[model samples]
Target: MTRRPATPLPPLEERRRLREAGSLTPDQLAARLGVAIGTVRAWESGRTTPRGRNREAYAKLLAALAESPTRTGAPGSAPAGGPEEPDAAVVAVGPAKTVSGGRRGRAAAKPSAFTQTPPPSSPFLPFLPFSPFSPRVPSWAPPEEEDPLGPVSDLTPVQAFDALYSFCAPSLVRQAYLLTGRRGLARESVERAFQLAWERWPEVARDPDPAGWVRAAAHEWALSPWHRFRPRHRRPEPPLSDASDRALLKVVLRLPPSYRRALLLHDGVGLGLPDTAAETEASTPATAGRLLHARRAIAARLPELSDPRVLHRRLAELASTEPLRTAGPPAARDGCERRARFWTRFALAFVAVLLGTTALSLRTPPAGHEPSVPPGETVRDVPPRVAPGPLSEKQRKLRAKLREELLHGPERLAPQPR
Candidate 1:
């Protein structure tokens, strides 16, 4: 018998090259393909063969190893060829293990880093769209009007008097002076609060009580970085001509931030203790206590100012001269209100059109038949009353046969007895 020429083996040659270069271990190659180490050894020794996808995987693995130092052996490593050594000699060098088919563990599990997550509901939250940071878009509609109660929110040491002075106008200047004991501080605080409201107009609109939000924002602003550096008193302050007003200022200024805040809320601005507490994020009882203490301190500090006539005359004079800042030019005041009204009208018109279109569609008669009932009638609400047409030839024939049989049989006998 003639012996065939020995077949050339490419896979066995590549496997032997990889081992010589130290790109992969025998156990690693076997584990990657979920095969026993003996199978990889056999392929390298040229005693058995790698088939189909295994051959493809082996080619890819070698290519990946050759290209990257991070993946394979470090840079300047040995190449995979050493043809002079026999394949059988390589297998003999390693220890043997008996193979068993069983469950695989942690080492064999595939990595799972590619999972996805659910996205948040609203793109805008905690931060609103129309904050001070948002760009201003000009509208042909109008200028934004200040809300009547807008000035009522957070009043800092300076702002408390400002809201009273500014809202009350020139007439209430003395009353405002009485409240702050410093007219200049009061005016500045009022102006700052207005600017604050303008900056956060969009957020303010969304708030349940815009005035409350403005008040809270103003309070935070008072404790802000800018406030800390500014001198307690500045030049060109408003003049408090009344001696009692001058004296009252000294007494109020001596109190702590909390006590002063409580007094300002109750007497100057007319906010009750509970409302003040809510705005300040304090309990009602605590706010009440603070208010009581603040009042007592003021009375003790200025016995003359505490008298009914002295205090009343000052506030009354201020009220008379100073009109509340709530009134402004009609054009300037209608900006936001006009925009709101326009959008509301647009929405109502859109809904009406939609409803009309739907009604028309429902009432439309189908082609090839006249409507059972005409449009713009009560019949639209009720179902169409269908009239029965004449029967077909087959039905007519069956009805005729049944009628003849009934008349010739039972009915015919009953008629004879009558």
Candidate 2:
């Protein structure tokens, strides 16, 4: 039986807008969604649309992107310099119609007002007009005559690390801060996570959820025991201008790590349930339960905030606070130092394995001295025999008698007598 294809999602412009709001290039968006870069481009160009799970994931991602503070500014405000009336273009979701004129007429009809402008604070200022997240032109195109986008595909290890670090450092630190109440501990965790990511950039760059991967690592490091021994210099806490928000933060910190992490990722970061599950390495249902439990626990503690909406708003406000220390890309370690650390760990592991093998070998019995066999089992050991010499007369007589008994059965001789 033939099946009808799913309806294509809302127009390419919507997808492009969401991508901009999320501050993600097509490649980065594809990586996050576990889709190919071509697929994201196709969707944005209205060449094709996502379906089934992909479609659902795309919707959730757009919703999450819309809510993210980094891209969308404050909760109620539109993105900086975004269109005042987004609904007017809702009718343009279907395939684009061919214009009645040649290329010149089409170019003339294009609205320059809607053209993307690069953010003033962007570090890659020289390449601002060719920004990957810009919807006006494909990011894969050459930026200039001399500086082609070839290097993007063949980025050096340091460049890749820097790109990932610049995009995600602040968000990672914020997540770490939520996991561990202390800003110092949070910074330590985030730095450690970025350092590890730098070491494994090749693998991480190809990961479907690079940000989530780093966030998970940061969470684990924040909860690690190694930090307990380090001297802590606590920064002054953000003033509790509102007592209710302060109280909520206290309650959130007291929850179990699982509950707290689930809650923070869902309500605090505006991640969908599946994304939260992926970050926490839990099943969707399990993550949902954790979130439910966390909300209930918080509500129980403060009856006034029992409404789900109120609790969620409070959590978002708490999570939006700036970290005590600003986060940046982790400094690249010297190749010599990295190699030394690797060899040191490898040698220690090798020595431990050798010791274990030796201990096991000593506990085993030597060949030919194994334990006794159980009943009905036979041992087949053949002892070495000495070379024979000439037989003695008595030995010869005994051998002749045994031959005679064998030739004429002893039973036949005894029967004849009976």
Candidate 3:
């Protein structure tokens, strides 16, 4: 295969050719190239041409598309540069079939564990119409039917966690960018949050507020094992349009850890005094006071944030750049189930042991239940006046007199209070 010379077609023609090839949509190409959708549109409209690095990137995109047959409509043929497709073979995915119980027989092919059915094509793409993936959603917005499961209303807790993240991840990423000022840090935290949420989906889904849980998880993740104890720089956001906002964020990143935490817990998470305090394990009043001071300090350094419009705009911008990392909670419900099974087995064994011991004890007669008492021993309910010890001579004489009197048919005694 011969490599073609770099064809510097006019911007409009180049964009048209890329679109005609059916390799990628303008938006997909733009995203892959890290350029704005509008930029692609402008190029297609002959409004502009890519220069330097962008030109190289565009060339690479075209080359990749040319090499990938499926991406570029090669009609059931392998890509130009890729290896040949393997011969067809049965791909089993379900339980293996067995013939007879008494005699061994051939096992049937089974379905694979990893196969996923792609969603059917529809005009709708989950949430919104134009930009299927955009930020700034109402906190209580529900998911759409176009999603893999059709709707979130019927989804299980684990599924809910995933659906919500797919919808909310973009905004969360943007928020990170706004709060941290470092785009990379913002991306890292949001991705970490998504990954962790996926890992503990069962528990998180069971939670009343899974998204909030992910938010908190992400916030803490930024200060991970590598950077937990490090002195963090503050990221101050100035007015959205003001270029100075970037510079101001650098200063915010320099704040002391406590001050930064207080400010971020309040502003970044939109947490109130009580919630922020609870998350930080501080008193509500203390948290409020600290937040007030932190905000004041940030304002003192970056006065632009004091403007309400600027602050709101910056927040909105941050909300748009949510970083998406590994998606979904890790599937670990099996671990929980195993633990539950262990406890259940242990309890059953313990109960059996206890019952066995009880039965053995019941089989033996209690010493106290014996009919006869040993010599010199006394039973609790026996009358004290009926002394078992050696009787005094007077008592013995009285006893003998009583017996004689009884024999004579008359005997009298004074009553005592005892």
Candidate 4:
């Protein structure tokens, strides 16, 4: 009797499904079979079919893997491959014999910890209605529910400000301190600038350089005269054993604010010339000049500090003397709320003034004109003006004939019926 031929194994897709059922990635399968990743990819993509020895080995590997039990069960525990049985029991039968079946069986079969079902909602917690307007949910929460306010990438004003504040506050305070030479004043300036930022957050957050806006505001506030009245607390100058370093600091403090700001923002804060110019509100060329002049001034005062390395070190030392003071998140939030309220009131008042002016303008009559008639009303027509000159002979004859026709009818003026 002739031996029955073996049925041809399933296609590459079926093979891939078997591999996936065995919890293996394509790369893992390729490595185990000692073939290039591209070869596996080609097989899966149907670009090329495995042949000869490769095909035979691949078929056997898939069959063995399909029959092998997953990590959740003992070897050869799973039934031979066919359509997955819905009621298959997924018993975790180690020391603990928990018999989870049905839909839970599939979830229990997964080896990955991430696939575990979450615990049921706590009974003690009150059931709160889900608000569409709620703020962002935590990262660990299931993502089945859609967010009404959209993704976090389109950040709200408060979130944007908070992110900016956390990122830039320390650097801004240090930059401000270098400008003002007073640590307390620097902190105050930075805080006030952040407050302004929070007020205009809708605009600032959308700017290409939110940090630049804050830096500019801090620069302006640090130089303002209001700080003078606030009781001055003299911070002890950090000891400079080298006379040249002390002299350098003195010269930097003495230079014009523009030059000083340019130097500190560029050299000290490590911002580029264009960013410095933006923060200083000057053209790039002007900013370059300020930096040039500042360098020349420092060089002239202390030639030893002219070297870039020395300058950088000296600036670092100076800035390092005072630690940056970051405002608490709560304080920042309160300031933002306060500024928001102020702007809200100001906007309403401005709108009110505009509306009142419009109403009054509508009510007042136009100059050199009486009250205009309503659109639907009709006015009597004016009589046409008579010509000033006396009537000519033709006009006189026409007028006499018209009067004769009016008095004796047309037949009397028509040479009678004849």
Candidate 5:
């Protein structure tokens, strides 16, 4: 049977962009394509190239997405892919209601005070063709002036990541510093966290709290015991200028790790009790206990800072005073890509080693199976003989002598019946 040729696909990077433009997640695309989500990931990441039917289907889907521009807003507005059409694009919605042609309708149609003119074309609406006399785009429309809290989700993957990093990095770095008492470690932790977030950007982007996701990762990295063995982390950073701040930090560090974490998340970060508990992966009561125990430990050493309010204020001051900063988003992204490539190469080398071992085994001659022989002697045949015939002459003579002796001996040794 003749097989149909697979459809040609675009560049690996473009495949991902098309999917993102369509706002279709890997899971959504996988479901549509009847393939595992990992397979979709491999295809997009260039780990595995699709073939046969899968290649055709995936290429077709991405081609459709590429053809349909995601930026266009509505039906009447000019399609983003096409050129501007001022006259054809006019969309006057909600026009006045027409009356039936009758005398009563004509009388009813008469203008009343309640009657209003049709709403003027909205200046914000993209469909409107305006004059040079019309007001220029507002100053607030600049990208930098965009409302940080407003939804800016219709973006390419990289742009969305930059927005997230810009929004979350400053506070995240400070939080990492508070977790680890070193500014350098804090900066490294936040930077590494962003690298990890970029590495798993799709999952991070879909998360409900992307900031929290990065925060958890940064805190984990900052608090890692492995950091103690590193040459850089073995030595402590320079102390804070304020003696009281140093003392407070020392008392905090002295607390059990869990308790210190709870205190920081709850009091320092201003997270709600439940949120602190969730982030710390403990129950509400357990987190409260840790938090209380930490606070009490601090109070023991520094009674003057006993009040929760005072402690919270002091902790915030200490965290804020640290000179922790993160690398730019683009730099972080490039580093993440480099790290990913390194691991990918490492894995390929490992697999190649395994395959080489298998090939070597196949080429080598196998040992033959040999049965073991015991150390005990082996009896080999010498001759077959009839043993009884040779002794017959000597046996007859002895038998006759023995009969005579037996008769004599009975007579000599026993009393006769007579």
Candidate 6:
């Protein structure tokens, strides 16, 4: 195949505008150009520019978008002027598949993790829209009918949560696994993250990227420094079955956590550098540096995996092929509810105990102002209680004489009284 000549693409901001003005989403453009959505996002975010054939195709697509009549604003967005990104106009457009009917125009983009909800229910993944694949990607029971990505109000909160869970959990588990080699740790991370999302569903549902919100939580938990101390995760899980896969993962694990994370988000998970950096809590440049370092390390060990696309496929494989399969959405939701109930009961019990203690103290307070004994005191003037020692023989003889002279004593006693 002949390589397309280098084409001068529009300015980065213009690229974003071109797509937005055309009512196109990242996934739409990705599908059209035969590239991963992250590649398109990277192009728009100015992290990495397209090259060779891709550059040519992108330039052509943008030129077509420029020529196409501009709509007032993209679907699901305010007309003309509205809040957009820092350097670009705000236009939210969903997957172009909404136009499958050829009438509704572009539907608003589906919520993120829509990676299989970031914590899909199993190891054998049913890759969501975000999964990297050719336009002809296959999965079981395409959700076109149920439309899990439909408007928030279309489904009850429970249904919506379950939808998010079913879609995102499996992918999230895989992602968490790649982040931390321990399979159980990965499952736990996704479970904990989803549980947290349920606790803050209000905030999460309103978020621009709810799946990403859970993804961030899961990844953070999986990569936490504290996990090393856990008895279950003290040592890494056994390596992957394939020798090549094991080698690739070994290289991945060898990198610093930050660098490994950047690599996973950017190359492994097909996220834009900006997203990767934001999720990893690093500056864009810093994220880029980490990604670069990570890629170089991988390349040094395994040359064939240098290409971002290949690396992504390998990472996905490594993550998905694990023996661990997570629980379903119902299970996740139930776990969340269970945990909430337990904590609620615990709090109520604690409050009741505290109140009871307070009431008991109030009911039986000190009756009187009972004097409290000081710590150190001794009586000074108190006499000894024992009578004087037995009188000598002289005292005994005098007592006998007094008894004999009782008559005379009466006169003496009477004189004394007078």
Instruction: State TM-scores per candidate.
Output: 0.32, 0.49, 0.37, 0.43, 0.53, 0.56
| Per-candidate clash tally | 10, 0, 33, 0, 0, 16
For model 6, state the Cα shift of residue 118 in Å. 12
Judged by lDDT relative to the true structure, which candidate is superior, 1 or 4?
Answer: 4
lDDT value for model 5: 0.63
Give the per-residue lDDT of model 4 (tens digit) for 293-325.
999999897887787545654565455445467
lDDT of 4 at 290: 95
lDDT of each: 0.44, 0.59, 0.50, 0.59, 0.63, 0.65
Best first by lDDT, ranked: 6, 5, 4, 2, 3, 1
Model with the higher lDDT, candidate 2 or 3: 2
Task: Report the lDDT tens digits of candidate 3 across residue range 1-418.
Answer: 5333232432222234445455366678789889987677555533345666776777666666556655322456545575332211111111223323311111122211111111224222232211222312211123232232233234355444445555455555554554455556766687767666656766665554455666667667664546544455344323444455445556556665555666665554334455667667789788878777766776788786775324433433333323334334332334445656888999999999999999999998677865787678555522358658888887778677666755654457789897
Indicate whether candidate 2 or candidate 3 has the larger TM-score.
2
**Model 6, stretches more than 4 Å misplaced?**
1-153, 367-418
TM-score of predicted model 1?
Answer: 0.32
Model 2: clashing residue pairs? none
By lDDT, who's the top model here? Answer: 6
lDDT of 1 by residue, 48-127 (tens): 44556775576566666556544223444334652122111121221112112311111012110010001223221111
Against the true structure, candidate 6 reaches a TM-score of 0.56
Score candidate 3 by lDDT: 0.50
> Better model by TM-score, 1 or 2?
2
Give the residue spans of candidate 3 off by over 4 A: 1-152, 156-158, 228-242, 307-310, 318-418
Better model by lDDT: candidate 2 vs candidate 5? 5
Number of colliding residue pairs in model 3: 33
